[model samples]
Target chain A: MNETGRPQELPMSNPRADRVRDVAKLAGRPARLKRGRFLAEGPQAVREALVLHRERTAAGESGVVHEVFASESCLDRLPELAELADGVALRLANDDVLAAMADTVNPQGIVAVCSFVDVSLESVLDAGPRLIAVMCQVRDPGNAGTVLRAADAAGADAVVLTASSVDIYNPKAVRSTAGSLFHLPVVLGADIGELVAGCKERGIGILAADGYGTLNLDKLQDENAARRLGASAASSAYALEAPTAWLFGNEAQGLSDSELALADHRVAVPVYGSAESLNLGTAATVCLYASARSQQAS
Target chain B: MNETGRPQELPMSNPRADRVRDVAKLAGRPARLKRGRFLAEGPQAVREALVLHRERTAAGESGVVHEVFASESCLDRLPELAELADGVALRLANDDVLAAMADTVNPQGIVAVCSFVDVSLESVLDAGPRLIAVMCQVRDPGNAGTVLRAADAAGADAVVLTASSVDIYNPKAVRSTAGSLFHLPVVLGADIGELVAGCKERGIGILAADGYGTLNLDKLQDENAARRLGASAASSAYALEAPTAWLFGNEAQGLSDSELALADHRVAVPVYGSAESLNLGTAATVCLYASARSQQAS
Candidate 1:
């Protein structure tokens, strides 16, 4: 305890520390699912949470951060955490102990246990929805993170992670977000049928990206031309519209038949080479950015 | 050695296997560099070398691959490798020993020792002379690999790495390429000034991607509007039009002024919201794809 009389040390006996530790271990499948909590480690992820918190504050939204843990050495080395947790509880732990809690081989020397940002299908759709990314069964932690990062960068209003996708809480997935997980509404464990239904209820269009599809993205981004094309495509025997949700599927087995049936639009990114397919992450980034560009132009 | 008058196997005294094992141990900096050659392992990476070998064969070019090595298991698993080794010596070793030489946490049960593919600046520029990616001082293997993969998908002629960039042969880097390195020309250890001069010599364009640059990529990709609004800006006064190479710098320090000044064009991918900036890999993907799009329109 310093002059202020508040304990600056890690409360080894504290229930909260125990909880954070428990959550950190839950980075594996069982724990992530059991508690409806996922572990996010590293400085970039935690820093993004702080920024998200600030954005929530500015927007008058409830964005309460649960807990922040740091090595005293980290506290001395980096000021961002102290600044982010100005009024919150910041506990110092052994540097080695803190290092143990980090998922990365090279720890940034800080970690945080955060509550998932809550956003519902209704909220995402009702927010005057336009661009969104629906990630289905993307298994790679790095790939999931990359998609989320791309979604955030492309200004997708929300990212819906289907049940088959890698858990968003995995430390790698969190790190991959490049902190975009905090910038937008990331809805995880969403059901496919319900997601499609929600989008339909909210008048959001659904576009499925297939490398073999007949539609060209460049033509889709043109408002006047797209309006004409989308009119015939949607109104005729086949078509789609703007205010779309782009659906990306599994890395190996792509979008299932049932999932594909839900899309009103089928689009493909052209490839000039012999490679079987672009890695899922790259495909999604290309499509999402294409959609973003189209939306921006219109 | 099996009986039946067979030649003595001598416990499979595989020299290539021994070399792979030695290279794996060299990942520790002192070892890697102490010997001028570094280990490039895994089936995909080896396959990449084989593809390069094929390209060189077709082009009547030579000196692409120095050697190919595999565990008896990999050869059994991929029988096609046997056919690919026209005159190259094939040596088999124990699986466990090969595993020891493997860099990935899970060895693909295959490893190869090959001289790095040496491409003169003239060769790469002459190959397509339209698009290229220049990387400076990028340290992360995965980031480097992902960039290579992206550059490949974007159809860039080659990926040039400065001396400070992570070793292209790093196992993670090799894996990240996801077999793209096989299809693409990757020139490493070239001085940035020389790379710039080579691109200029070939009548190629140059664009340096910087976080602080004011150029909007969307405008750059919009050929019709850009042609009218910024014709000179996109051509003589700014853009390099003959062919083009987009330069990317290290993740942390970004491009130095000297490197940045060497480019004919500088552009930034616009960012909004509270996120700091895109990851190096993501930024490269976005920039490379943008260049591809710009070239397509042109």
Candidate 2:
């Protein structure tokens, strides 16, 4: 213990001690996820966020990291720690205290409280995003992260999550993204009406993925196919064009009538098995990949 | 109390009482999952399994359904209950007991303990499965189920899981499958080498999805370009002409060196996101869909 009431150092080499500390923090939901921030543990998540921070610093900009905390023991173990914290604020906290801030029981001995990088529809759209994934009332953090990852892999423009969806910054969600969350601009809390209007203004087609809807995903991906699925509309040269925005809904209840009606088209993945529907994460991946393939083929 | 020494039946019509019983059971993991049998609570899962059972029975074959338990009080509430329970052995277990057998905390007032269905590798391959999914050491039940669901949707022949993987019949895995488990043949507890050899003997190409490995999935799918990936030779026949199997490993240590070497071909999904890697379930889905698309295009 140090004079500052914080442990002067932490030893991360011991897996047992590390797990014990991490479990304690993650056991309590409140301590694990506070109002303004959440924990980002796990080597994959921490490493990705750290790389994003490094990229910003290398470009002569202040790193995006809000704060960096690592077990004293972890500092010695991680050879690149010094490089990651070159111009960023750093902290030495007790392993347990740091674990308490994490969302997983198995902490990676290092975590970063990176503030959410706010992104806008205009900025993301301006980057020539050909494919965008919009999530509606999908509250599962893991599902949200998976969607972000799928969008990134398919080389989509951006991923925008609606207000009712899970928080993109949630530790579990961020980790699930496998670091793709950092590569893509993730926008949270967008009004659906305003979003649809913004896309309309930008001449971007809105495609809603609804389970109960009639449109077939494979059919929609094929432009040569004449019949469109649900909510088909006339193309406005730029609008109703290829490389459009895709909307996905809540896992249980699915997209609301209002949300479905707002789209220019609705599509459903054809099912041969007895499954009533696909998992939200699986469905999103399939849809995003379908659109990406369509655009690529064209 | 019943003379049979079973606890007194609680009225199911009372929402508060039903909720109390349901929560109590979910807290006790053992009560939710036991040897040889597990709970499948959701309507979709319960319905699908029942339908599969019926299809078999209608074909002049017998099926095993231990018991059908439902809320006696709500028998009149949901008119379809009777039709849904089409001639299954029924017992009016108390609402509290039924809750104990439910997988979810909020019981849907429906559950069943069907005999665990086991399939032989001969039967799976005999069906001329063009696509197969193999999990080397996937440890998460949810991930296992999600993979199975994806395999089913993409029209994979079957999913073979090793003993090192989580139990496919685990309640959480079953729920995650959303009824795909019953729709497809899932073989657990198998020798990896034997399974690989068996598939090879059947002229099926085995592809291991390794994140750290060499082959890019996109390039492999590109038929017009160099379709070569992994150590094995690419089949000149279209992807549909060659039966294929995909192997996924544990979340932490991924596929072992030997397992990767055993692959007829190996491919990695192109990643653009910051996520260290995709979650096991998401990765499996992506690979399965890619193969499906390639085969369709070919």
Candidate 3:
């Protein structure tokens, strides 16, 4: 190991090495599932992964990051990553080798092979989560990641993707999360029906984010704020301060009839202008933030 | 014109034609600027363009749509497009011709050439805009469009892009807007210094969306909601309900010092979790919606 704790021996210079090809294969679903690992690329994601890895290891749990590959110049520029990866399998590689193992043309000169981070739904529900975000059949990787990142920003306890939803471990989805992927617990390939029943058994409210919903999210937020501030005693149909799971649906069709039927209440983020509706990510962010503020404020 | 009011006489079949090349060039800045026109590809954008065109022509103003090209299948599926383009020059074209002229791999079988729709800063100020979103050197086309769409959903009076920002008329930007581009006014090539001065002169509050800002957005919202609900009479440093202009910075580096100095206050969206920060679109949405709710509630 070098003085910086980054390995300086046998730098990976061959882009077509068998090891490099093996790492690159993780970009596909079959490879990722078979190996029980995924790639976390770029500085932000890799840094967060390393932090998580350190925390888990320090706590006597299995680490999340399996191995990390970084360019020498990357380590030189962001030395904290090298320090954070002290006991991990750290390898110095050329940019071409790094790129060959990455999904993006430029992985910002760093990438990490991370163990699957998703926990079982029971594990998340057992923690008594106050706020959760669920995506049902959300097809696009970008949309899926956006919702996950927004959920993290909103302080959501966990995120759940129903069966048939885009894979959170997809390279593009991981990039879109912008490191928030490592910030919170996630449940993937979950059955919406079973998840909803599990939440109900645990006394969690379910809200569906729908454009044509009967309830307005703003009114609920306003009511919650008023109630919290001692302004009014009026009761809202749904309380934003309660432990809740929000269901967000497909980008184009939104929540299907079956999906919408599972929710306790259908809520719409008010659109005060001519826009037909907010995009899935925008709507989901608004809903999550509203719930977060109400629960936190109270 | 046929019975459906579409120009079915001469179907555009040759993708190699000079006219097709000219239309295709609208995807680039030089061609767009030279012709003072841009492409609105796909069903949603073209339909919105036609709606705006009809409204303008009915009011004795010049139409926005110059020409529209569509495949027969697209018009057949969406007959409203035919009715909306009654007074416009609409030509039926084959999918190959349409694809050749479009920037996207799939134009969804329709495209429109529309005049530049940006208005002057003075015009926006004259309209007494209560809410404005200004992008300063934000280079991503998708980010620009997301902000625009969010602003529309929030009922902002206008959106402004300062010098060096991405061109909102870029094809990708237009597609990202999802037809919200036609729902509100936009100003382009704005100088931040002069624009701030103009907004201040019009009694509009200037708020910069900064991560390091001293003000917390949630506190401001809570205070505003409390005051509006007669729960608290406490005053905040900045009134979110007042006529306000929000400045969003570049995706990577954020606002320049000069740009940030122009704002009356730098307000940061409250991060409730471990996320380093929200993405440009998410932050912008939260800010705009907060302002919209505050202003509208009062």
Candidate 4:
């Protein structure tokens, strides 16, 4: 180890090396689950992982980034990554080696292997989250990632992917997150029934975003506006400003009747146009942002 | 042609037929432009196109769908399609042939050849649009398609793609629209400057959605709330409830200063969380829905 506690670096010029193959294997769910590691591709995701690792290590927590592989030009482009890599292993890799280690067609010259950093559902709930996004059976990786990005952007305390949901560590999902994966706690493989019960017990209102809900999201926004205007006292009616966890369902089927029954209220984002419905990701964003805006105002 | 004005069809058994190659070539921009036709892949898009064509023809306008190629199973699955093919040519093809003519991994057993239905910028402006989404230099086909879907959902009158933006007919984009492409008019190759000027002449307020805008979208929503409360007069302030065209810039660079200056107001969708920013599609959705809700309430 060097003085900074980072492992000695070696130039990786061979794309067919065993190490490259091992890193590339993280693209598959089976390999990721078996190894408990995943590839964070591109400069943006790699930098975020390194930065988060540094922050966690500084706070006496386990680091997230296992190792970083970057071409010389990539290191030059993102010099701060070197500083962020303190106490970590860094490998100088050739373009082909970096490409082979990444899942993207053009990885922008960097890739990192990171341990699964998802927090336990218990841990996430224990922290008393104000805003949470619970995705149920969201099969599309792009939709899953986009929802995560939206959740992060809305300043949601955490995002929970139900037991049947797509793998958050899927390369497409991770890529869709645009580095937001490293920004907040993501809980995976939680039982929906227990999650609902847990949130109810924790004083968090579990709201289901459904197209057929009797509760209109616009009305919810208006209620918040009424509260903001001091026109009415905050009643027992579901208020978006209150601590809440939004339950979103499968892209195709949406929330089944049983799943919808689990929520405190099923709220529909009002569709004024002739177009049938909003996609899962767009619906999630509008719902999260509605809560976010109301909370900020309150 | 049959008595119903629909072409009598035979089962297209050959995957390598000249007609199949001609349809497959529409996946490329050059062929689509040259032939003035594009492929609308999958059941949803194809169904919507045929329905729209029927509606238009019933209203004494030109039909949109020139022809539809579907597998026997697809036709069996969607029996209503037979009714929709009233005046259009229908060809029964093998699954392999349908797949070859589509851009998707799975084309859902049908593809439709439709003439370019984009209206001129002048026609869009002539309609005196209440809600429009103007995408400037948007390069990602997926983002462009998502915006189209969002606009359609919000009941926007039309969507204008600037001359430099991605081809609205791009196969990936067509797939992303999820059939919203046929729900409304989509204008292509419009000059941004003329659009702004045209919107101005029609008393349509052009609001630029930007990250660095002085106006916050939440505040804009608040203004509508205030208006709804009858606390203030609608004055000269740009109102979401008013006839408006939202101008969205490229995903990466956003609106150049010059472009921002062209709009009456530059508005930012407030970012309340640690996420750097919402993706272009999500941002556009929130903005469009905000306007949609306000307009509907008014």
What's model 3's lDDT at A271?
A: 98
Q: Write the per-residue lDDT of candidate 1 for residues A115-201, one digit (tens) a residue.
A: 667478777777876788998877888888888888887788899988868877788888888778788887888888898888888
In the range A1-298, model 2's lDDT, one tens digit per residue, is 3332233443433434554454334334464455344456755566677787788778996666666667766766774664556556556655665656566655666777665664876777767667899999888888888888878877777889888788777677877787787787778788889888888777778888887667776555433212122223433222223758889998778899999999987778766455567888888887777666556644
DockQ of each: 0.27, 0.34, 0.86, 0.76
Per-residue lDDT of candidate 3, residues A1-298 (tens digit): 9788989687799999999999999999999999999999999999999999999899999999999999999998999999999999999999999999999999999999999999999999999999999999999999999999999999999999999999999999999999999999999999999999999999999999999999999999999998888888997899999999999999989999999999999999999888878998899999999999999999
Worst lDDT 10-window in candidate 3 chain B:
B2-11
Model 2, residue A56: displacement in angstroms? Answer: 4.0
How close is chain A of candidate 3 to the true chain A, as a TM-score? 0.98
Question: Which ten-residue region of model 2 chain B has the weakest summed lDDT?
Answer: B223-232
For lDDT, the strongest prediction is 3
Compute the lDDT of residue B206 as modeled in candidate 2: 86
Q: Against the true structure, whose DockQ is highest?
A: 3
Segments of candidate 3 deviating more than 4 angstroms: none
lDDT tens digits, residues A53-133, model 4?
Answer: 988989999989998887778777777777777777788898998888888878888888999989999999999999999
Summarize candidate 1's per-residue lDDT along B61-150 as a digit string, tens digits.
774555555666576677676556555555565666666666665566666666556467667766766888889988998888888888
Ranking by lDDT: 3, 4, 1, 2
Q: Comparing candidate 3 with candidate 4, which one achieves the higher TM-score?
A: 3
Of 1 and 3, the candidate ranking higher by lDDT:
3
Q: Model 2 off-target regions past 4 Å? A: A1-35, A57-63, A212-215, A220-241, A296-298, B1-35, B59-62, B73-78, B93-95, B212-215, B224-241, B272-275, B294-298
TM-score of each: 0.83, 0.82, 0.98, 0.96
> Stretches of candidate 4 above 4 Å error?
A1-10, A232-237, B1-10, B232-237
In model 2 chain A, the worst 10-residue window by lDDT is: A222-231
Candidate 1 falls in which docking quality class? acceptable
